[model samples]
Target: MVPGPVSNDRLGASNGRSSPKPRILVPEKVSPDGLALLASDFDVDSRPGGLSPQELIDLIPSYHGLIVRSETKVTAAVLAAGTSLRVVARAGVGVDNIDVEAATAQGIIVVNSPAGNIVAAAEHTVALLLATARNIGRADRTFKDGKWERGKLVGVEVGRKTLGIIGLGKVGMKVARMAVGLGMKVLAVDPYASADVARQASVELVPGLADLLPVVDFLTIHTPLLASTLDLLGEAEFQRMKKTARVLNVARGGVYNEAALLKALDEGWIAGAGLDVFTKEPPEEGSVAAQLARHEKVVSTPHLGASTVEAQENVSLDVCSQVLLILRGGLPTAAVNAPLILPEEYRKLQPFVKLIEKMGGLYTQHYVGARGGMVGGRKFELVYQGELAGINNTRPLFAALVKGLVSSISDSGGRDVNIVNAALIAREKGIVINEVHTRENSGSTYASLVTLRSYDTDPAAAGKEERGAEQIIEGYVSGKTVYISKLDRFTASFTPEGTLLILHNYDEPGKIGGVGMVLGRRGVNIEWMQVASLEKGDQGDKGLELSKVDSAVAGMEAHGSNTKGRGNEALMILGVGGVVGKEVLQDLTGEEGILDVSLIRL
Candidate 1:
């Protein structure tokens, strides 16, 4: 019998005691190779033409999985209608058409093949660059119109020319390699990538656009479109480039300002431009993009960067594998949101995952300070203790930790860090990671504990007096809630959520109230507060009064103190609401007896 849409009722009744086979619906055309692979184990229904939004909503509730290409929009209405949908698989990268937030909120996994089009995009970038530089498009049009004006087709050679790349990601790195093979000097600017990574790619790493624009003969952008990158090349940036420089953008639309680019082209700020993507696809007739496409100095394509047969096949197969794995009760490597942890393990370890992520975020934010640049050559160590150490799959937790750590340092264009690319990005930034699992509790009060530590490779680089100072944070799961148990030597407990203010101050009575006053003045509400004194030991209030005396501070001097030999130190962890500005932080730090204050949002 020809497979038709299977309803949830039919599926549930198929096996009285056993689970039914997952039914997958493919509304858009995919490679036969991918379809055949899914057909082997699933009830596959393949339809080449996509369905309308209403049609999709009507048919979606029957199936367990839905796969599509760019043509189909996974709207929130459709997601809400998919009563049985476990996954929404996109055949290619850039899930602009998918409402990923809605899918994630509905507990439906969204997977995309990010690596499938890297080479295709890179080749297209180089192709467009060479075409623009050599006036290939104009020459072809003139020749087809029966004209032989060789003099008017004078062009520049790419050999030995400097190419500045905006982002050194997968596609950008491939472009760099291809440019180098053509004997071009490559310079790149990526905030997340280290100098070591740039050297490995044989490219010079510039700190930002200002440093990269003036020196290069060609500029290419490969960054995703977001608030930070939208209209990245504006009038000011275009003016910074050499008048003869060329521009290429094959990564995303809206990254280059259409108005600014047209102005640059018309004003002769740049010689030419090659574009494979635009702010609006199929730009309106008589629009700026349409006019630019017809310009003699511009060569444009209809978003054909991933049009190769190999790229389509690769993405189709890649997303198909992920869908099958997720349906079969396995974790997908390229999941765009949180991991699909096993039900039992997820119930037990979900809070722990959140706790560790917050801890990692808190440590990185505190270590890097407000300037927000990565410390060079650092190492991240994760230690899992007690019953948490024996979990069969710890990859998800590691990815969560790395995600939090990297997200704190880099601008990810609003994209989430996931298991597939977290470790890869960490390696790109020259971070060495080590993981340890032990059955012992490690002298912790809780049953399970996770500790994260970050340190610099060079001892002197970490600090002057405190050489090799490591930022350590430990947490544990208790029942349904997660608490940060210890930070450095101070012991306290607070739920790892929302915004937090950690203060190191003199062990005096008025310090806590002083902090409260500053936050209150700033209109920030304190939800919870925990204070631990290093000099007071773990004896609670009695130890506090005892350590208040000056000579008694000497007895507890073994515990580390920020102000050594002067007095005992107190640590306050405050859960706060609303924004805590630098001015408020400065006020808190300026308060008497307040030594240091660090704020983090998780």
Candidate 2:
């Protein structure tokens, strides 16, 4: 039997409510404990079987809050029908079925139990890993069929084996702890997590998947399914793994290529696989996932990572607590949208937020174009200069900067990259963050400035010059407009917006015309341009000509004679209308005096 709603008076005068209790609608079955807690302070209407879309739409208008699990699809239509709904809470980590944008559009807060089922999912991952390693599923099935296949059930031991974890998030970290307890060596690769965080967990931090793949006896993925991580473990990755290695995916379905896994298993590229989720839930009868489930070397389960009773109760309670907090006019801890920043402060920081985000995006893309990839190491430093340094609250701006920096190089999948989870995602990837606050003007021309730099920690490159070893980008707010003031050593004042193409070239004649010809031939229009040249001292060109000349060349002794015509490096920053294609890029690079080129889209 469903529990009856409680009166608002039961919550006492501290709740500041003399009116009727807030009405909460539970369209899907939740833990009884969660319902009882809601019933203690609010009116709850629960339907265990869950209401159909039309039924939910018809009943949602009367509720002040709605709580649901994965089964209920909170579509835009339902959100549109929810005239009085103030909050929509999901009892699980993934809100795949919830239209969060729709809820936000209606000014309804959407909350999720991000950490409630973490342990359950972690335990489930370990269970699947063990099951796959020991051939427990096959053994149990054959024994139940009355066949004694003892000799065929030989298994590998997980102890002392290397386990490579793709993401060290809440569930992933728990799995790391459990694996360590089981005597396994853990190697984690997360671009957002710092080395200190990994050291605290006793896991070796690897920078890339290639570094982790060949060494691990077991490869388990915990990263979200984004454009970068979709089909993360495909043919190439499977080929890199040891033939005796096992693969596990308890995070998401699309993380591993199902067809590739089937082929890997059939071709003996991997020993076994344990999958709790699939790209398509309840995979087609004859699909690769279904075939893999029937394979002797594979162990598969329905999506049950958070299926435990304890996990269900925890998520239900967590989300319910958030719903109650919001209804009581308190801020929620796990809100997945813009933070509850005060209006006055928000207005002050709004322009800076956009400025820093664009700066970060431009810097990362510029670095990748120059170095052929993302920044080498995980450590990054953020400096707030001039008037901006005096602001006590800069967390939101920092988060925006990180979101912009990481989102450009990685795939966020369906998850929204906002201030709330940006730092969380950054930490999961082992990205070290150092923030500096200073009130000194530092001779800045603007009232405020934000600078981001990625520290290169390569031992081999430590002895070399600093020019190509690090990345630094700076921006500032002028009045209401935001402009990028500097990039590396070249100084420029240009609005960091739209599509931009940056070129590093010799400070010689005809270079600009050559680049312009290439862009013109490709039908690309230049909206704006900024040029800056490296000073003689800045380029270390003071004694370069003298050192290069022999004593026999007496007339060449003067530095002016050797370098008067050219040699100083210059930068051309072009704001273009459309994408600068590879062909145009190649032509630009091949032009005389051109050294490097990078394109950034903001």
For each candidate in turn, the TM-score is 0.72, 0.76
Clashing pairs in 1: none
lDDT per residue as tens, model 1, 1-602:
01123345433332222334677889999998777778878888888877988999988777788899989999999988886787889898877788887877777778888889999999999999999988999999999999998999999999999999998878899999999999999999875555666788799987778899999999999877743467888899999999999999998878888899999999999999999887777988988888777788899999999999999999999999988887786666666664523444566667776777777677666655532445435677899999989987886687677766655544332134655566775675577678899999967778889988776556445545332557678888878888776777776677767787888777654565566667777888877666665634643432221222222324333333323333667677777777777678889889987778887776
Candidate 2 lDDT (Cα, whole model)? 0.75
Where does candidate 1 stray beyond 4 Å?
Answer: 1-21, 194-197, 285-295, 338-340, 359-372, 375-377, 383-393, 406-430, 436-451, 458-602
The most accurate candidate by TM-score is: 2
What are the per-residue Cα lDDT tens digits for candidate 2 across 184-277?
9999886555566678889998768789898899999887776446787789889998999999988888888889989999999989988899
Highest lDDT scorer: 1
RMSD of 2: 9.4
Output the TM-score of candidate 2.
0.76
